[model samples]
Target: MAAPSPRPAGSYGMDASWVPWLWAAIGIVYLVLAGFSVFSWGAPLWVTFLVAVLGLAFLAGGALFWNASAHGKFLVWRELLDELPAPARVLDLGCGRGAVTIMTAEAFPRADVTGVDLWRSIDQSGNSPAAAEANATVNGVSGRTRFVTGDMTALPQFDGGSFDLVTASLAIHNIHSPLGRRSAIGEAWRVLSPGGRLVIVDISKVDEYIVHLRALGAALTVRRAGWRMWWSGPWMATRILIAAKPGASS
Candidate 1:
């Protein structure tokens, strides 16, 4: 594929942009109520002060959510990218709009990166295979990257032991069930070549994944991703799980 003119690479777009918008909207409603309480409702001073403070807190929370989605997640991903060894074939699960996909392609210039997704906008804002492809073009990695419409729970198009590196970022949690997430993780492990690495960054149910991978005999290490990955606050912090598939890569 011919590479399109390079756009400034920072356009990863926000994850679930409506979340922050909703938080800010609620904050505005509270602020309006706080003003009415003090001016017309004739409420007590402490009550109005409390309402105003709550409004500000919600607004701040929204800002943090927006920051994490647009910039903070990428910060954490960049660090993870640096730590990754170069792979000849990379597969990214649920790669919404190519944020992690394009980054991996750029990080490993020789690697052929492929992103698979269901293109559900609920999981991410403006998510589509076309948008992901366009993002790859914008980042000048179109030549080496491809996006496909597929479910992580069942990737029948790919053969077993097809990839050297498999990655997922805040994606498997969308499965919404322990069994479904386990199936997705199992597929990821299945596609991974012997001695390959599977990296997952998720906000919930990572322990369940660890348990499942351990059952598959994968050597695993997991760590909290820290403040840079906090979606809304520390309570929603993400975790990274790295599982090394045993044996030697042919």
Candidate 2:
């Protein structure tokens, strides 16, 4: 695909709160301490060696953070885009700053996309409807895209059989109540016409979500997001689930 227009300023984003650079920060501090120890007069050989080793470990940890929390999130969008087809109705649940939302619009320009989010800064920096709109505008898909503020659990606001594709990215697990989370998934199911599909990327209780969706009588697949898709790598937790509502090409 051709390169997109300049990404909207302060619209595309990173959330420091989601995965803080504490490991990277600590690595820098350790390297500094190791250098200081080496240069200090009469520094013990073993102490310097130990500090160097510690620094290396933290550095590796930082790489994991960048891979899992940063790069891995984008893979979610790539996979979803692969699954979606053109000229379809799409919804993004908890589309913080339109990261996945705008990408979807850009990937399938013919498709109509809508992003809904609470836009709570505490949820993710740049998580706002205005940011999402600006992102879509600069990305050259604003004409076919829109953002709205709404709760995932109470998304009955959308009419039944209104959408062909629905996505939730790293957002649904925030629903603390089991009932609320199930309801939110149900809402996703409700908006889908036959043959519609739902894709979700989440951090916890993925199996629970699978069980919930299965109970709702849909065909679905659930699996670990794996190293490339897990920003935190295999340990920190991430999962992908895809479900189809059985019917047309949605």
Candidate 3:
């Protein structure tokens, strides 16, 4: 097998690259229709104007999404991780291609990071355990990083309170079912050591996660994930959640 390319600093594969591609494709179609209406069909002025505006808007949105996926998202995660104390053990849920996993390793130099994911391509293009492993290699965290093909809702390989820090980024929403997502959050909470921290960034079902964690007796605080985490626009923006498990660390 060929060797993995060394991913450069600040260089990471796209997260849901298809989302932006779909946006750009739709924008192109709209622009084409607008051109056809203006030149060949002599369609209504308002119709042409509307389509043209939509085309430009969609294209702009697509560019933003692409930028955010490639660069902005990592910057945001790095910034978020920087504010916390160094963790000795970290668990990254749904660590597609190791963006957050590698970030955690870099953020906490002494930490041993483990990533778990189902590696579905629909969730992230080129998603695979090997891809995640290669990313860790290229990012110079291979020695301290590992990837496992597993579902977040049920992490059988790990014991409860196994990690000092748990993180999920743009991953939990993929569960599709509310109960399943809640279970995943419960699992994250389960694997956290006492006084350990759980940080999640997701675009959907934020309220459900917060409520579930609150019910579990976690001290929860949440806020907007900011524009860098916006998948397409503000309407689809992600949020960051920080939950602290009770009791002191052993």
Best-matching candidate per lDDT:
1
- Residues 22-78, candidate 3: write the lDDT tens digits: 999999999999999999999999999999999998998898898778767777787
User: Model 1 off-target regions past 4 Å?
Assistant: 1-10
lDDT of 1 by residue, 1-250 (tens): 9953222374556788789999899899999999999999999999999999999988987888887787778888888989988999999999988888998998899999999999888888788888888888877899999999999999999999999999999999999888899999999999999999999999878989999999999999899988767776787889999999998952
Query: Global lDDT of each model?
Result: 0.89, 0.77, 0.87
Question: Where's the lowest-lDDT run of ten residues in candidate 1?
Answer: 3-12
Candidate 1 TM-score over all chains jointly: 0.92
TM-score to true structure, per model: 0.92, 0.82, 0.92
What lDDT tens digits, residue by residue, belong to model 2 across residues 172-224?
88888998989889899899888888889887767777888898788987777
TM-score of 2: 0.82
Model 2 root-mean-square deviation: 3.4
RMSD of 3: 4.3
Evaluate residue 156 in candidate 1 and report its C-alpha lDDT on the 0 to 100 scale.
Answer: 98
lDDT (Cα, 0-100) at 143 in candidate 2: 91
